[model samples]
Target: MTTSTTDSSTPAPGAAASTDERIAVVNPATGLQIGSAPVFDAAAVAELAARGRAAQPGWEAMGFDGRALVLRRMQQWMSDHADELLEILQAETGRVFEDSVLELAYPLTALGHWARNAEKYLRPQKAAASSPFVLSRRLRSYYRPYGLVGIIAPWNFPITIGFGDSIPALAAGNAVILKPSEITPLSIEVIRRGLEECGMPEGVFQIATGAGATGAAVVDVVDMVMFTGSTATGRKVGAQAAQRLIPASLELGGKDPMIVLADANLERAANLAVFGATVNSGQVCLSTERFYVEEAVYDEFVSRVVAKVSALRQGVPVAPGSVDVGAIITADQLEVIDAQVRDAVAKGARVLVGGQPVRGVTGRFYEPTVLVDVDHTMACMTDETFGPLLPIMKVADADEAVRLANDTRYGLAATIVTRDRARGAELAGRIDAGTVSVNDMLTHCFALGLPMGGVKTSGIGTRHGAAGIRKFCATKAVLVAPSFPNADIHFYPANEKVSPLLLAAVTGLYGTASRVARATPRALATARRLRRELGR
Candidate 1:
């Protein structure tokens, strides 16, 4: 990882340019260098942010409809280039070709949704005045863009998180400077070109590739920051934004739980458990990490899960039909997974299926693992094992399941598997997570109208839905008063005549007595006298 500050000779990004320092983009599955990008330092990050700031005004001039048009064109471009994009996704992130489909589909859906609904969601909204005195004035709140927005996306689902976030920010009329994870920078470059091909203004969308330092530099310059990663990094980003008094939306880590009740469909629950825990090699933040099955059905459910786990195929993940699990992103991640599993075994947890890293495989690959008898004391149960490690524990009842599920600091998402859909939904409500699914695994995150985010350490703000676009904007209160010949009663210096009338008015409106009771003889007389004196 090489780093260089921006200078006069710094060529435009995405073009082949050799500098003193560059970051190599290696294929995680092959351990081969496929590409390289200039490692931008603080000065380069600042320069890109400055460019975005300068371009924001013209982009904002496009307004909601005009911006929506650009986003739709981007969606079309994505469709046109789908094959090439999917190939690049597999090359970099090592996700199975089927899972990589979402990298394009999700952003396209979000683009279409935001383009069609932005005006409705962001249009000035009328708000009622709290007091009678202001009833005659019209009150409305307008949502305006935050000028230049800085986005730091993760490698797990680069296109979706990167451009999914940018679509709404752009639709809301703000210029963006995105820094994709170094591991998956190429995918985002393709997205940038799509935006530019669709006639987005120069500098309106930018990508800076590097490591953590690059992201921190972006935060230092931009008006607002949107980050998706781990909780520890999210805290640092939040603190940096706080120091600058600029708001940052963080989508962080999760130890998502799946509650399997006695009434659950045994086969269906087992299938869901395997898919939920093993998808993307368990790299997803909302992936199910812990399973709490009712004691009565524990043995059967565990056996079914172990069977599914054993049947899963681990490979390079390039082929659509042959692979179910892909390579881990890095060797460091594999070591972390191994350490957690070792800790769990030492602490009395038993591996029911695959437990160790895959040997004689190309690149960083790990077996889809299933562990039984895992307890809270084990590291794999308590900490975020961001690999394909499924830990199952038995609970006496639903109450115990809920208690154990809520024990973790992360609350990004959870799932409830039961025969009674109503009961599943009710139990979902009881879980302390941002998104909850009933009789499902990850379906709750795909809808465009629903908000997605986490509570506690999971994240600070929401993404998607109307709230998604609004997150990139700030609300401004607008008040318009009707023209009148008479001045406002409370505007002038205190006068003997108006003082008593104003006192009586306050007493009549806000006093403890009923309106009729407050309208006593003295109050009525005072009102009449004021009306006459004021010529109302």
Candidate 2:
């Protein structure tokens, strides 16, 4: 994998606006500019929104069943075009085809789940009975769309993260204006082209192409912004959304942990740890950054992880039949990762395998590295390296493991490898991360029914299954009175002391069996009479 070698020879008909559009689409697998386009100006952004607004009323009026059919069709269409989508994904991110296949599957599964279940989860429902005798007053809650949704997605797993939000937002009856990462716009283009081919309304899923400025414009105009990227940038998006009184679901960053119990199968734990940390060259939000192992098992885990890391292969992204780790997304990201690892080493961390750069690899490929004796103060441990770097620390027991795991500011995900089921549950409870896996790795996020969002700096709001679809809609409470007015309950102008009296009577009735048993019929009759008079 090399730095971007984008295909910028000629514009693809209508890929951009003017002839001088300056958007460069780079292939992270081999630092090449494989494509180029125009940076969308504010006018383009407004145009996208205008289209969404036009499509809104009709699309939303179709009801849940109508939407579900379209979504299911899209799912089948995605499955049919899986090979084509995988090609684009591989070209953009340089991930192995198998990994790309897995990434693509996540959004497809989520879309299918939401389409089939959106009505049940997002449709209006009557709220619980608020007050007895207040039953005549009808009250309900409904989820309403936020008009158009702006999703500014990152490059890593571009399809899933970008379209994942888009599926629900569209299913819940909101139009979507998606600004996919310029680093990997091919997958975004595929989605856009597919939507267009499906006869979906033009503005229902607008595809905007550009860099950070394009993403910022998305945040500027939309009713809601769903951003997935760095913590620092997430804060900026969050603050802007706040100022505009719009909600932003920001998945900032994560320094995820992997806790290995002493009795764990060290071999399985090591294999997964290496895969989790080094996969996709480790540009993952939930990449295992810190590993807290029992003192008895630390050495074994470290040795195995180091050996696995050393054996991984790196090559051009489009290479077939070989597991090739791709390059870091950009040169700037490469610099950031380098600094983190260097600082970590400076701060007492020891590199175990493939620590330095390889001479033959052309792109931003850092060797899959394992570090031991890493402290919390080390940049590799504290900051999001987002590279093929893992730091293993020794802990005396589960207490210290939990303590160290929760020490970070971000709480996205963590894993506990243990043979004992009861002990896994106990340790899972003690861990502060949002998603925890017991005796396994690489799944938690793909569970369509699970609500996956982070606490602390990781994110606000959720996206995946039930929560995702419901999140796209707004809750509106509908209350209606009986068609004919009843005069018996109309004591509007009175002292309203009846409220307290009724409460006291109900409280007395619920006080206890001993008190009720000791009370006379006369006392109970008086309470019953008050309740009847009050329309309870």
The lDDT leader among the candidates is 1
Q: Worst 10-residue stretch by lDDT in candidate 1?
A: 1-10
Q: For residues 1-536, could you state the per-residue lDDT of candidate 2 as single tens digits?
A: 23334443222223335234776776665666666655677667776677778888888898778877877877878889987788767767767776787788887887678878888788678765445455567788878999888998888878888888788888888988888777777677677767666656666787777787778877788888889988888998899889998988887799999999999999999988988888778888778888899999888788888777777877666556576566777777777777887888888888877676545655567777778889888888788888888888999998998998999899898899999989998889888877888987668767767877789988888777667777666678788778766453435654465554544555544567666555556556655665565555
Q: What lDDT does each candidate get?
A: 0.84, 0.77
> How many clashing pairs per prediction, in order?
1, 16
List candidate 1 stretches off by more than 4 Å: 1-19, 514-536
Q: For candidate 2, what is the lDDT?
A: 0.77
lDDT tens readout by residue for model 1, 1-536: 11111122123553324336877777787777667667888887777877788889999998887888898898899999998788878878777888888667788888899899999999999986666467568899999999999999998888889888888899899999888887778778878877889989988998888899989998999888999998899999999999999999999998999999999999999999998888889998878999999999999999899888999988876467878888898777899899999999998888888889988866898888888878998988878888999999999999999999999988999999899998888888889999999888787657878999999899998988888889899989999999994777777777887776677765655565566265757766655554454345
**Each prediction's TM-score versus the true structure:** 0.93, 0.90
Cα lDDT, model 1, residue 17: 40
Residue pairs in steric clash, candidate 1? 6-44
Model number with the top TM-score:
1
Residue 385 lDDT, candidate 2, scale 0-100: 80
Candidate 2's C-alpha runs over 4 A off are: 1-19, 488-490, 495-536
